[model samples]
Target: MRNRAPRSRPLRAVFAALTLVAGTMFGLAVSAPAHALGNGLALTPQMGWNDWNAFGCNVSEALVKQTADIIVSSGMKDAGYQYVNIDDCWMTGSRDGGGNLVPDPAKFPDGISGTAAYVHGKGLKLGIYESAGTATCAGYPGSLNHEQADANSFAAWGVDYLKYDNCNNQGISAQTRYTAMRNALANTGRPIVYSLCNWGQESVWTWGAGVGNSWRTTGDISANYTSMLSIFHSNVSLAQYAGPGGWNDPDMLEVGNGMSFTEDRSELSLWAEMAAPLISGTDLRSATPATLSLYTNKDVVAVDQDSLGKQGTEIASAGGADVLAKPLANGDVAVVLFNENASAQTISTTASAIGISSASSYTLNNLWSHVLTSTTGTISASVPGHGSVMYRVSHGSGSSTGTTHPLIGASSNRCLDVSNGSTTPGTQLEIWDCNGGSNQAYTLTAAGELRTLNGTLCLDANGQGTTAGTKVITWNCNGQSNQKWNVNPDGSISGAQSGLCLDVTGGNVPAGNVNGTLIELWGCNGGANQQWRLG
Candidate 1:
């Protein structure tokens, strides 16, 4: 049974004094490197089980003990579920005389330290919750004014993980608030995995690596197919920022939570493709065999735990059907074909489509089946509506290495300019003669969205096809499929909206008039117009 709030409490003056001291101690600013907080602790995708979706604020010492017991006995521990997290609403109204934060006496009579000891005794790490804002999203006390005190208390309690949320933090820059906690944690000299949960504010991925170990790249995930897919899609553009010690969290796992199986499988596959964390958000004690099987597939888990730590990118989509691909550390590739449509759709993709050379014979491992098969140069699979099929493709026999430049850096020598006066949307984009101009400098975000050095969206031809004459232009940053462009080494740009390569229509080469030339999508012709010099 879920634990509820107590009807009565003892009013204590010591609680007030502890709060005052905590506020006073944290009021002083500390100077340190901003990235110091995430510098310590586990550098891999955190594998854990959180008690929020199943129990919410109704958690108790008994409940935690039962969950911990189940985690140890259920074989999830051997499968890599280590951290047992207690999220939100576990705090008491006050701190103790030792300057240590107290857990709600009714729910945790032994305090947080006792809970940590118990969890550690089970050979699992312990994780606690806090908020950077004045109040948590669930309306509990936050660490806004108690950064140092909270950090000290948490460290003393032997807390191994901290999921710092962003809620009710008004009038404060996220950087400043995060930096404060970071400094506080560093002062304690304890290694804690600081997870910055801000729902991707201020382009968190762009700077999150300099702050926390992981950042929530999207909003909360629900226990349904639509909700899970929506959250997964939202993070597609930010895939590049995920890596060792820094990850783009798509929220906790919904496996074995009584959600639809199709949705659960799709969610698992997509998360694997993105290389996101696999923290289970289900009741381990009552988990069904199917759920356990789904969560324990070592083959699929390998994709999530790939050493390369590179996030996957979407290659193409048609009629709500999309294909996403990620390069693995073993030089193989992982592919996810998703059918977001109302009905089933057959999604097809080639190795070359995802920047890999076509193999004579490829070993295709179906992540869902946990089985492997050999296929020729081409492979196709059918995906159900709101479902996905994930695969690991490797060379079956011979390895053919090809020169592929998936991404290009923008520098003084390699850059090209857009025609002057072509800043508006739908303007034809061309690779002019190389010049170290501001217009030539651009940054490709991990989300695959192209932006000017100052952060303006580089759009595709009305967000559609590879036809000859699709114009490229600049627009405000909106995460539309059309505004996402994948830079290829063949000196061509492909639109995420249509999977069409940016072409110099008809290979036109007049100097100044290259401005109004029609931009179209075409095959990789290796023409001077198709080859762009990235600056």
Candidate 2:
């Protein structure tokens, strides 16, 4: 990652450069090895239970112990669910006699040490939380000026994990603050998995591996399908930043928190396929068996914990049907057919495009149903709305080209269609379901023209507006700067002329309100509404 905030100060710049050199020396030594740091911890994504997504500020010692007990009794412990994390609001408003943050006596009557002992007794790890700022997200005491004392206190309490947050820090450099906690944790001599939760500020993925075991790559996730879709789309575009010891956390799993089963499957499969942390974000003590079944699906977890530790690449994405392929340690490939469409549709992909090159016939193991089948060329499945089908595809050659296609938003099950299918210049684009119309089709040419299949129209910024909120439309194929868009590696489509991003207007809109939301050019802010995948 970019040497993380190089500056004019010679000493600080050298330290930053040294940190970069240390990670680089090893990083280049192995050609993207599974363990970038060789940190001996989080060899795969951290498997755990987090309180905030499930219970928020209502966390208590009893609740955490009960969760630990349920995790043990439900056989989730054997399934690789390890840590039971107490997120924000677990601490008091102030610190203790030694200036160490304190757990609220009333809520955590036995305090953090007792809670950690109880969790550890059940063969589970304990995770504690604090902020890099003066106060946490819930306004609790933070470790801004007391990183060493707080880290030492956590170690004394036998904590096994740490989630360092960022909130109300007066805009201190995130790199400096997070590096402070990293050094603090290291100085404690206790091996705790560090989780950086700064809401992906300063593009944390660019420099996070050196600071923590895993880092959040997006905003928090809600118990809504749109939130999951947004986070999934964002995480898929960041596959290069993760490995064995470090991961790109798109928040935690919301499987049992009232989203649809299809969406839950998408969340589980996408996270596993992408090698994201599988931290359960549900009230485990009261969760139903069905929910645990989804969470502890052995086959899906198998893909996530694979020794290869390679985050799956989006081999194919088009027409709202996406294909993700991850190479496993056993020479087989794990492929996921992700359908972000409103209706169930048959999506297919060939094994060669996914990088499997060996045998003539490959056996497919269904991660969900345990169904086994064989395919000679293409594997296909009927994926449901907002759902996915994952398979372990074996025996195929790795020599083929993948064609990219257009991806439409799932909230409305629509394509990026032209206004009334008009060929006229200045015809604005709108969302409509895919009917294979020529106006709805687009080809991302090597020269950056999003050309229609009919070969007449190209995407253009309306009226040559160079400001935010400029609507984009289809116009005659003229080679002008306004018609060129860079499909960015960060999953954004930026205008070559204005340097703005093609964005969806509704910022975090309520479910079902995304239809007809104007597509405009805005300053690139890396919002989920602005992210796009070239299919």
What tens digits encode model 2's per-residue C-alpha lDDT throughout 1-535? 0011123333542343355457666774322224344457998899989988867789899999999999888778888999999988887777778787888899999999999999999989999888888888788887897899999999999999999887767668988998898888889989999988877666677778877889887667889898898878777867887887898888888987988655776789999999999999888887754466567677789899998888998988899899999999999899999988888688898877888885678888767644456778788886666778888887743211123355453233346777667888777776665677787777776577888747678899998888998989888888888899875433357899999987767633434225566678899754445544332
* Candidate 1: 10-residue stretch with minimal lDDT: 404-413
Stretches of model 2 off by over 4 angstroms after superposition: 1-38, 396-535
- Taking all chains together, the TM-score of candidate 1 against the true structure is 0.66
Q: Which candidate is the best by TM-score?
A: 2
Flag regions of model 1 displaced more than 4 Å.
1-42, 96-100, 397-535
Cα lDDT tens digits, model 1, 433-532, are 4455556556666667766634554545564544545556666677777777765422356776666666655443333223334445665433334444
- Report how far residue 49 has shifted in candidate 1, in Å: 1.2
